[model samples]
Target chain A: AQSVTQLDSQVPVFEEAPVELRCNYSSSVSVYLFWYVQYPNQGLQLLLKYLSGSTLVESINGFEAEFNKSQTSFHLRKPSVHISDTAEYFCAVTRGGADGLTFGKGTHLIIQP
Target chain B: NAGVTQTPKFRILKIGQSMTLQCTQDMNHNYMYWYRQDPGMGLKLIYYSVGAGITDKGEVPNGYNVSRSTTEDFPLRLELAAPSQTSVYFCASSYLESTGELFFGEGSRLTVL
Candidate 1:
């Protein structure tokens, strides 16, 4: 069985400050990684994904996550955050041939203005 | 296109009541999924369908039932609502299962009293 772990339950950062949300996964087979963001009262949106090729995947909204196979980690990062960036972020994993994804307990990124 | 759409954005039910959450995708995606989000729990897959008439249980499917009669519709049914089932329900769809990005609906918030 595959499982995901988000190390931080909450990440508080000041506006314009760098932020990182840690995630780790355990899977017996090769997996694809993804980062999803959810705003208040909304559904989750795909922030970024690591399917193949580049280990570092980026979203258009200045968010990026690196997939480190050796460490079983795919941490999301942003150079600077805005008040609008305050949301819940989730890390998910799906192994080869799987039909569904396994998600971690999300990290609430609170951007302090 | 309305990538994914879920009806009844919010609902309140008494214990032992039954209801169905309707989901539809106009993108003609072959894969559809149901997930529930709770505080700090990110999202847990409740059920998934690879295509019409092909449904499977996901990580958390104990109290839910689903049917995929058509490619565009996948509805989740709760036999007997419970307080534990009070959460935000999300419906998503993707073109493929192996490595496809998911498009999600806004979500349905359900409160069981």
Candidate 2:
């Protein structure tokens, strides 16, 4: 079985400040990691994913995440956050060939302006 | 293109009432899924379909039913709504399996009293 965990329930950061939302996963087999963003009253949008090759992946809006094998972590980071970035972020994982995903509770990224 | 579309942006129901949440995707994705998001929690899978005429339960599917009659339409049915079923419902589709990078619809917010 695979499980994901997001340590922080909420992360408040000032505008233009860097922030990090930590995610960890436990699985017996190979896995793929993903970070999704949900704006207010909206569906989820794919922020970034870690399939293979690069341990570090980035999104278009300056969001990035690094996958650590030894620590079983895939923490998301943003160099400069904006007020618009205030949203709920989710960390999810799936096995290489599984038909479903296991999601973390989520991290509410509150960008203080 | 409308990646995914869910009907009835909002709905209110009483105990034991029944309703259907409509979902459609223009991407011709073979895989479709339904998920529910409660307050302060990540999404939990409700139902999934690999293709037309095939459906299966997800993490949480006690109060929900679904059918995949065609590639574009995957509707979720609530047999007997309960207060616990009050939440935001999401429809998602993916071109392939083994990845969590699915395209999601806006969502359907349901409030049961």
Candidate 3:
């Protein structure tokens, strides 16, 4: 079984400041990686994903993650964050042929103005 | 189109009570999933369906049951609720075109008293 671990439980940053959320995974085979964000009282929104191809995947909202196969990690980073970017983030992974992703404990991103 | 939908946005139940979380998708997706989100914990898969008739247990499915009778409906049943089961639940669907991008519903908040 594949598992994901998010090192940080909470992250607080000033608006417009850069931020990075660390994620590591445990899997012996090929896998897919994903990052998802959940705003307060809302469902999850996909931030980015790395399935195949270039290891660095970008999202529309200025978020990006680099899949480091050597380290078995996919960390989400943003050069600058907004107040609206404050939310809970989750890192997930799935094996090559599996249909579901295994998720890590979330990291709460709090943007302070 | 309504991507994914879950009903009873909020519910409170006594221990040992029973309830069913309703879910539906209108995007004609072949894959549907049920997930539970605990505070500070990322979403955990409870159940999943490959199509209308094939349902399977996920990472955390011991206390839950699910059925997929139609392409659009997948209901999660909690036969005997517990405080440990209190969490926000989400329903999601995705196309096979991608293994990591899923469309999620707003979510259902369940509390066990």
Best by lDDT: 2
Clashing pairs in 2: none
TM-score of each: 0.96, 0.96, 0.96
- Distance from true location, Cα of B8 in model 3, Å: 0.6
RMSD of candidate 3 to the truth, in angstroms, is: 1.2
**How many Å off is the CA of A96 in candidate 1?**
4.2
Candidate 3 displacement at residue A19 in angstroms: 0.9
Clashing pairs in 1: none
Query: Over the stretch A1-113, how does candidate 3's per-residue lDDT look in tens digits?
Result: 78899999999999999999999999877889999998888998888888789999999999999999888999999999999999999999887332777889999999999
RMSD per prediction, one decimal? 1.3, 1.2, 1.2
List the per-model TM-score of the A chain.
Answer: 0.96, 0.97, 0.96
Residue A76, model 2: lDDT of: 99
Candidate 2: tens digits of C-alpha lDDT, residues A1-113: 78899999999999999999999999999899999999988899899999999899999889999999999999999889999999999999987442666789999999888
Q: Second chain TM-score per prediction? A: 0.97, 0.96, 0.97
Residue-pair clash count for candidate 2? 0
Candidate 1, residues A8-112, lDDT tens digits: the string is 999999999999999999999898899988898888888999998989989998999999999999999999999999998989888734367788999999988
Runs of candidate 2 with Cα error greater than 4 angstroms are none
